[model samples]
Target: MKILHRTEIEKILSSLDPIPKIEEGFVQYSKGLATVPPVGELLMEKGEVHIKYGCIRADEYYVVKVASGFYQNDALGLPSSNGLMLLFSQQTGQLACALLDEGFLTDIRTAIAGAIAAKHLAPANITAIGIVGTGIQARLQALYLKKVTTCRQLIVWGRSAEKTGDYQQDMQREGFEVSIADSIDELAQSANFIVTTTPSTTPLINVSQVRQGTHITAVGSDTPEKQELASDILARANLVVADSISQCQQRGEIYQALKAGSIQGEKVVELGNVIAAGQGRADEQQITIADLTGVAVQDIKIAEAVYLASEKK
Candidate 1:
């Protein structure tokens, strides 16, 4: 079996177009062409590991991805997330390649998914993009949104002042008009499109803070205890979308909303359905919310792309 290191996988991924590939995976998933089992998780005191695996019916390879995150790793001078993907041939059930991507692949695919969510759900005209949390995802989400939207202004809110300032400076150098917001409410009120990437157990953005026609793509709450937006905010949205209805029902922002009884479980729409049908949001005045908990099909598609690209080289 071939072993591809993180650096090699990163190189292969840099040349690949992830948005189309990810969108295709979502379409396939919604069309019942992909087999995705329930996500497995192992929670720890300081970190968590997630096991996601899936296969497309017509694909030659299936993927099993192991991803982990430890917030305390920052103090130890190490990255928080690092994991690998195991590829197996569907025809022969033989091991194909082991991609030690160390979660780089996950980050890119997730950012692309965020972009896809905005493309279908966010308003056609965007004044400003609001970002919560000044981490790798915050940077990636802002950069990818530029490709799908023409918004020039970026407003960011972070728990740390220094980190938020650093994010503002870095994004400014990257040709974005970025500003650090004093609070989440300020960012919510100013920007029409907001992406929340913080791993917070408590809600940060409330219902009263949002304006009419606001669109929020929530990406941080992958676990049961992690929630970024208030339950009331979801109830107030004109439409709510989920990447995986089953996964979100068990965890993510949707789970929190459902448990609080703020929104009915049946109201949330799967994002793939919107993508496959090429339909969503009838008017610009409608408020939209996308709860993205990530999915295994995304891993299979991205891993397949990188593996094929590597083989071509």
Candidate 2:
């Protein structure tokens, strides 16, 4: 089988249009054309591991991905997360390729999901965008935001003053008009489109701090122990959406809200359903929340995209 490295995958991703492909993946999943099995998980003291596998009907290949997030790795001069994807032929069930992406594919798919959430749920007249955390995801999230929205003002909040300042400098060079928020509350109130990228177990943004007509995309909490927003924040949201209802119930911000009886299990709408129906956000005044606990179908679709694109190189 052919083997691809992270550098090759990065090059392929630079020019790849993932929004449409990922959106189509969501549609196919919601229509029951994709078979996504339950995720296998392993909890680590510093982070966690997620094993996701899925196949799209009539697709040339199916994929299995092992993605890990070790928050403490950065101190060791290593990436916080890394993983690989294995592709298998649908027609013959033979190994097709191995993508040693080191979690780059997962990061891109997640960023795309964030952009999709903003495209369908964020207010049209956005004044500023807010980002929590100054990690790799923080950078990717900002880059993807530009793809879906015209908002240029970016307000960021990070626990580390040094890191936050560094993030500002790095993003400003990219022409983002970045600002450093003093607190998470300030960031939430100032930016209409907020993306939380930290792996915090405690809630950083309060419900009272979030302004009306704000759109919050919570992508940090993919594990049961991780949370970014208070349960009340989700409770008060006019609309609560998830990448997958089943997965959210097991983890993510939605899980916290559900466990606290703040939101009904049935009221949670899946992002796939939202994409397929082409419906989201009732009005500008209504607060919306998109809790993206990454799904296996996204991995499958993104891997397929990378595989197909690399062939043309």
Q: What is the C-alpha RMSD of each candidate to the true structure, in Å?
A: 1.2, 1.3
What TM-score, over all chains together, does every model reach? 0.97, 0.97
> What is the lDDT, from 0 to 100, of the residue 276 in candidate 2?
81
For every model shown, the clashing-pair count is 0, 0
**C-alpha lDDT score of every prediction, in listed order:** 0.91, 0.90
Q: Give candidate 1's error at residue 300 in angstroms.
A: 0.5
- Those runs of model 1 whose alpha carbons end farther than 4 Å from true positions after fitting are none
Q: What would the per-residue lDDT of candidate 1 be over residues 143-168, giving only the tens digit for each residue?
A: 88978998889999998899999999
Report the lDDT tens digits of candidate 2 across residue range 40-87: 988878888889998998789989999998988989999988899999
List the pairs of residues colliding in candidate 2: none
* lDDT of candidate 2 at residue 77, scale 0 to 100: 100
